[model samples]
Target: MRRTTNRSAHRAGRAGRVRRTATASGAALALALTAAACGDGDTTGPASEGEFSGQTVTVAGVWTGTEQENFQKVLDAFSEKTGAKTDFLSTGDNVSTVIGSKIQGGDAPEVVMVPQVGVLNQFADNGWLTPLSSDVEQDASQNFANVWKDYGTVDGEYYGLYFKAAHKSLVWYSPDAFAQAGVEAPDSYAAMMETAGTISDSGLPAFSVAGQDGWTLTDWFENVYLSQAGPEKYDELAEHNLPWTDRSVVDALTTLGELFAEDDLLADGAAGALRTDFPTSVQKVFGPEPQAGMVYEGDFVGALVTNDFGRTLGEDADFFPFPAVDGGEAPVVSGGDAAVVLKDGKNQEAAMALMKFLASPEAAAVWAEAGGYLSPNKELDLSSYGDDLTRQTAESLVEAGDTVRFDMSDQAPAAFGGTAGKGEWKILQDFLRDPSDPEATAAELEKAAAAAFKG
Candidate 1:
């Protein structure tokens, strides 16, 4: 449910893609609120006084192209306003490796942008993150209270600040195409399926599901699970208390497999999904001759489509919340990037000051304008968004009183997340190619989940 825009799809092209060669065994941490011990209480070698006064803070993350351009504008503005010199170390990929190397070398950035929530906890556990409760206290409600008080906290301390959050569980479609096919916005999963089938019958593909990165499929499963099981079970599963073979998990995967089985539902046999790259697969969705009726992606997909197809969200695209399923409560799946102060940094006060500033409504507004990311600060007026689609998305956040955090795949233990993507996606792909043995596939996934959780 993280904001996996089309930009994430381009991660494969990151210049310094750090491929994790070592595979470990453990229950992948889920994006859930669980109590755990804090780090070793290591201060980054006694916070230096006025260390940041004349020093240029180096920021690192895997953002480039237009995304970088947008981020730089914000950084430039921050420097102009605060007179805090800043240097952005933009990298194409290998974000973890780059950050890890910096930390190991005792030269990590003052503030690091971590996209995956699961890794944040791991970093904190390793004494690699500095607590930020003081910053949080400066401005409380402006931050997404739950996310800050829960996921960003460990052992009663805050170590991260939410800058921007993305709404997932969004189904984007060509309004023109939907109208041409005589469809209405679906209010339920059943209605959505019926509409999809009808759209396909009208000679258009139903959905564009990119399974190459396997994370997209994870989003589908998480959304369905959230709708079917509600927040409690979702949180339990994320915390590793529930097994993947549970009825709810199986039910969600089964639902996705059924969608995949539908004729003309996904582009060219969804099994081909395993081979298509993330960017290419997304391009197919927003192509000139759009192949699918709808695409389930995060807010970032709009950027990807715009960058690749020169299509704007409102002109060529619009989105609907993924329809409610199993008569469950309605909630949106939201994800965003958080700035974690590394425990190894020498400028804790300066870094924390920057974080506090970032949490301010003013800074959030600037981020919205610069990066197209929804500000976590509720006090920030979104009236200036201008674009109808963006405004609608922002409104959805206000309306979503209970947001399911990012998908467990990204928030859970890395092993489980990876297995869920690689293992679960393969199972889904097989079922799509031929809906011959859903039970067997379900059993296999259940076993895989057990193995992952057992570790």
Candidate 2:
């Protein structure tokens, strides 16, 4: 729905984005946590008395509730550094349409925090995005991996920078629950299934499956596909260079069905799971009387467990990397929101300044210390994270930078990937409901994908 005219319908029930880590080896990088400034008046040191004395910058994004509050902390840092008045406008879930209408009315914000790469592509295609300045580009190159930069590029021109990252390849489980089952985290998918089976035999269902939220299904498929088929096929499928009906698609779906088809492995059987949304699924696993021992999703689940359930990560609950499919490196599927400037903005200088600041580790550390956040910036020290589990999780993401892939469905056309009750979301929901035939499921996915890509 990137270019949709029906803003209201699109806004009603859009799926929440579940959205990170470090370098190649499992070890943390040795880069200095902070770079020294050349002189006392160095602009990099911090905001001078009034760097941009009389400017204002407005940023729009789909973040609401706590996410919005955390993002505001980042903006507040930017304002304090540059002496600019910063404002945030929550676009709800329909950012594309809301921003599009604002642009049409000649009132677009100075910057937009795009939640999907698909929508960023849409905005870039519409000629609404301003090509970022060389300084901002250099700042991004220094802070982020080439993969993050690639997501913001359109036709060889960089237009944005990923400000926040989400690692979607985590499996959160109760430490006590794992001990009760007498099992540890497994490295490969086969071993994971065995672990789940052992846990289930110990009187608790193994996994909390959030079937009611179609996006969760897409994340599950993406991690398995990326692990089994590898990154090359992932890129091809994401771009539609490889059709959805390809053997790889069937293989991935079949692998996922190994979990979906097992009623006993799920917290609530298949029917109850189909009625369970994301938050409820988390509750079933982490609440006082848990029904399930584990749940699989992004690192954001850490925040929910801590804030909502008052559980401390690494003690009451913790997460492991989504297991490998065929015994190689387990794949890391990441998601993020990028800050892109508007070409028609009233204060281009201020917006670009904000963009440059957002690309710096200093800005990222502001939110990182606040909890429930991860950064793709290679230089940000893992210590900036508030907890040990978060530090280790962020380290894993950084370690996998060379092989990491963004959320697959997010890289597709919004009509196919982001929308609810249609295209990939609905089709995956159907597959979850009845995963008997992987081949048939792949065919249906291909049909929807082809039509969406064609449009």
What lDDT does the true structure give each of the candidates? 0.63, 0.80
Candidate 2 lDDT, tens digit per residue, 1-455? 22211223212321211122222211111110111112211222224455565666778887776777677677666666666666667778888899999899998888898988898988999999999888778767766766778788887788868988999999999889899999998888999999999999999999999989889999999999998997778878888889988998999999999889999999878888889999999999998889999999999898889889999888899888999997655888999999899998798887887887777777778789887799888778777888998888877776676467889899898789988899999989898889999999999998999998999
Clashing pairs for predicted structure model 2, backbone only: 19-166, 20-166, 20-167, 21-397, 21-398, 22-397, 22-398, 22-399, 23-398, 23-399
lDDT of 1 by residue, 1-455 (tens): 11212222222221221121211112110100100011111112111333244545566656666655566555554554444566666544556777788888877877777777776766776777777755355554334445433566666567667676788878888887788889987989989999988888888888877767667777777888888887768776776678666788777767777787765777665666556666766676678877777888877777777767888777777788888887975546777677777767775655665666666555655546664677545556666464777767866764453354566776765565654345555555565566656567667766666665565
Which residue runs does candidate 2 get wrong by more than 4 Å? 1-49
Consecutive 10-residue window with the lowest summed lDDT within model 1: 28-37
- Reference-based TM-score of each model: 0.83, 0.89
